[model samples]
Target: DPVVVLDFQSLYPSMMIAYNYCYSTCLGRVDQLIEQTEFSEFGCIGLEVRKQLLYKYRNDIHISPNGVVFLKDYVRKGILPKMLDEILETRIMVKNAMKMNNKKQNPSKGLNRKLDARQLGLKMIANFTYGYTSANFSGRMPCVDVADSIVAK
Candidate 1:
C-alpha cells in the first residue's frame, strides 16, 4: 500500500472568505443551547449554527453551535474578511499580470520580478492571519475564543 496526502492551499483564508467569518458577522454571545430549527432560515444563504456567549446588547434572538453567527448588517461587512478578500483579489490580479508579461515576445524581467514580489508579500500576509487573530498584543480586538472558533472549523 502507498501513503497519500491531501492539502488545500490557503485553506484558512479561503474558508474565512467563503464562510464570511469576520468579527462583524459574530452576532455576540448565544446564551441557550440552540435547536436545529432555531434561526434555521434567518441568516444569509450559507447560514450555519454554533454556540457562543449571549450578549444582550446585540439582541441575538436565536442560536446554534456551528461557530459563526452572521448579522444582517447592510451598512458594513467584517473588516478582517474584507481586508483578506482585497488582498486575495489583488494577488490574483498580480499573478495574472505576471503570467501575461512572461508570455510576451520580449518579456521585461523587472516587471515580472515586481509582480512576483507583490504576490509573495500578499501570501505572507494571508498566511500570518491565523496568528494575528490570536495575538495578545497589536491586534485591536484579539479574542482567543474567536481564533479558536476559526481553527476549529
Candidate 2:
C-alpha cells in the first residue's frame, strides 16, 4: 500500500492550546473570577458554566508531548472523546513497557496491545526528526542523524 503521509503544521502548539487551557486570555480571566467567588447559587452556576467551557476547550486541543495535535474539534466537542482516551492509554502503556523492558520482563503484551499508540508516538518523533534532518542535511533544518535514529528504530 502506498503510504499516505499527512503533515499537520504547528501540531504541538495547537495541541497545547487545546489540551492545556492555554487558549484565550479571556478564559484565563474567567477562571480567575470563578476561583475568587465566595460561592453563591448564581455564582456557582456561572462557575460551573465556565468550568465546562474550560474543559471543552482543553479537550478540543489535546496535546501530546512530542508536539502532535490531534485535530478533531467536532469529535472533541461531540461524537465521542475517544481520541484523548486513546492517547492517554497509549502513553501509560508505553511508559509501562519501557519500565518493564528496562527490567527485562518481556514487554511484549503491553507493546502489542498498544501498538497503534506506540506508532502514533513514534510518528510524532519521526516527524520532528525528519524536520531536523531536512534542515541540517539540506541547509534548512537538516539532521540526518535524527532521521537515521528514527528510521533505524
Which digits, one per residue and each the tens of the lDDT, describe model 1 over residues 1-153? 999998986777776666555666665333322554354432222234444433332453312245445443343456777888888899899999999998999999999998899999998898778677777777655655446656776
Q: Candidate 1 regions off by >4 Å?
A: 1-5, 29-68, 72-76
Model 2, residue 17: displacement in angstroms? 7.9
Best by TM-score: 1
Candidate 2: residue 46 lDDT (0-100): 28
Clashes of each: 12, 12
Least lDDT summed over 10 consecutive residues: which range in candidate 2? 20-29
Estimate every model's Cα lDDT from 0 to 1: 0.63, 0.39
RMSD of 2: 17.6
State TM-scores per candidate.
0.66, 0.24
- Largest lDDT belongs to which candidate? 1
Which parts of model 2 are misplaced by more than 4 Å?
A: 1-81, 105-153
Model 2 agreement with the true structure over 16-102: per-residue lDDT tens digits: 223431111112233343564443222113222345654666655433333222334444331112333444455656766666665
